[model samples]
Target: MEQAVCCYRHQDRETGVRCSRCERPICPECMVSASVGFQCPECVGQARPERQAQRPRTMTGGAVAANPRLITMILIGINVAVFLAVQAVGDSLVQDLILYGAWPPVDPTSGVAEGQWYRLLTATFLHQNVMHIGFNMLSLWWIGPGLEVALGRVRFLAVYLLSALGGSALSFLLANPNAGSLGASGAVFGLLGATFVLMRRLRYDSRPIVAIIVLNLFFTFAQTGTIDWRAHIGGLVTGAVVAFGMVHAPRERRALVQWGTCVAVAVVIVALVVVGTYRINH
Candidate 1:
């Protein structure tokens, strides 16, 4: 006896769906799925801003609260776990995993030249003592969450690993061949450099960052021994390079540019290692 209702947006089409929020007639084509029920376009448009405002501010889909800097936490966990394993195993782990550049002519057993090049990156996970791991982890904790949120998980990881690689390569080139080094200081310095670059890109005052960097550099060279100043400098510069591209990349081609920059950084580090090895071998 009663006539069927037609959608407000499509008068010719009949529908039974109604917007959950406003209780307006809507066709299937005009429906937008919501938690409770379908919504009309008008309701969706009006509710969008409020929904977005309620959501946490994040550079990527994962929020800091939901994931809590998942990548950063994982890295810290790995470092701490490695540190504990080293303590349990004794100094042998340090002897094997520490970065040893070719120039210093380390013992063959040390594995610098027997094609175990992974030390370039692996050394970053090693630490000399409790103080070393403690300080590095502290610095990572201080900077990691903010940087991870800013760069997103993947890009943040790329910067860290590449900076570690750069640190070892430069340490190899500059340090005595037999000089061995280990720690996440390179990666930690990388975060500092990235933060500095991002702040500058966002047109924010970077003097405090500059001041912190200056203090670190002062401590690096100012230290008495085994400081691996070269590694710190290398990581800082490499991180800045990566961050520069990430910050300046065009929104339309951001992923492509960021990924390409990572590849280029890896290539550069590999090239440095090859050249350094060759010069030392000859």
Candidate 2:
């Protein structure tokens, strides 16, 4: 005989419906319409806890099924993977990815700069060594999620990437052309600056952020040769500018203003790089 097909709740009433979540047989009377499909009462009751467990969490909100800080996690993963690859391949990876001050600029080692301009962005994903990557990754982990939540994923990513470019542009203008620089320091500093601006916007006590920034700046300058102060300052300034635009944007025109601000900042950074490069070449 064919297996009996009946509602779990009402065996006497045969029905084709099933709980979408648990796949248990359900009668038309027991069917509860959901966004996707019908569900039984028991499944509906269990749904809340299941959703809570399945959802990704944001720093200051209820769990949502949408991935929280997904970009931040991806960034961390890429950096870690690059670090591991670098460990395996050695200095060759660094040489290819490291940001030199300027393309076509004179260099002692290679005689002339041959690295492509994309190195500016790629360099942010590269690191000098374990300690360097460790500190930068730690800073990203601390500041990334909260900022990601506040800005939303795309905007947060924009701030990070633009800040990295800003840092590299500044390094191009200021650092010795022959010197190689690499790491996520610029992006980490960008997150710090964004956090500072956001805290100020929310009228939260921003003194602690200021203190952290100051402490970091102090280390940046004090370390001299080891630290790239130009990159730090550039990233900080870019992130602050972006955050300021985000905070000050008119409620009715927020997205436009924020994105426009990012575009404007990018154009300015590019112009600066071109001008600096021209001056250096001439």
Please tell me which predicted candidate would have the highest TM-score against the true structure: 1
- Clash number by candidate, in order: 3, 0
Expressed as tens digits, the lDDT of each residue in 1-282 for candidate 2 is: 877799999889888878888999999899999998999998788887977677663322223326667988999999999999999999987887786665444532321233256877888898887899999998999999888887777778889999999898888767776678778998788889999999988999999999999999999999968788889999999999987887778767877888899999999888867766565556
Q: Show where candidate 2 strays beyond 4 Å.
A: 1-65, 102-115
| Residue 273 of model 1, lDDT score | 79
Question: Candidate 2, 193: how far from true, in Å?
Answer: 0.6
- C-alpha lDDT values of all predictions: 0.83, 0.81
- Candidate 1 overall lDDT versus native: 0.83
* Per-candidate TM-score against the hidden true structure: 0.80, 0.76
| Candidate of highest lDDT | 1
The alpha-carbon deviation from the true structure for residue 85 of candidate 1, after best TM-score superposition, in angstroms, is 0.5
Predicted candidate 1 versus true structure: per-residue lDDT over 1-282, tens digit per residue: 999999999999999889999998999999999999999999999998998778763442223455757888899999999999998999888887887766554444335456679888889999888898999999999988888888777778888988888888888766776668788999889889999998988789999989999999999998828699989998999999988877778767877887888889889988887777766656
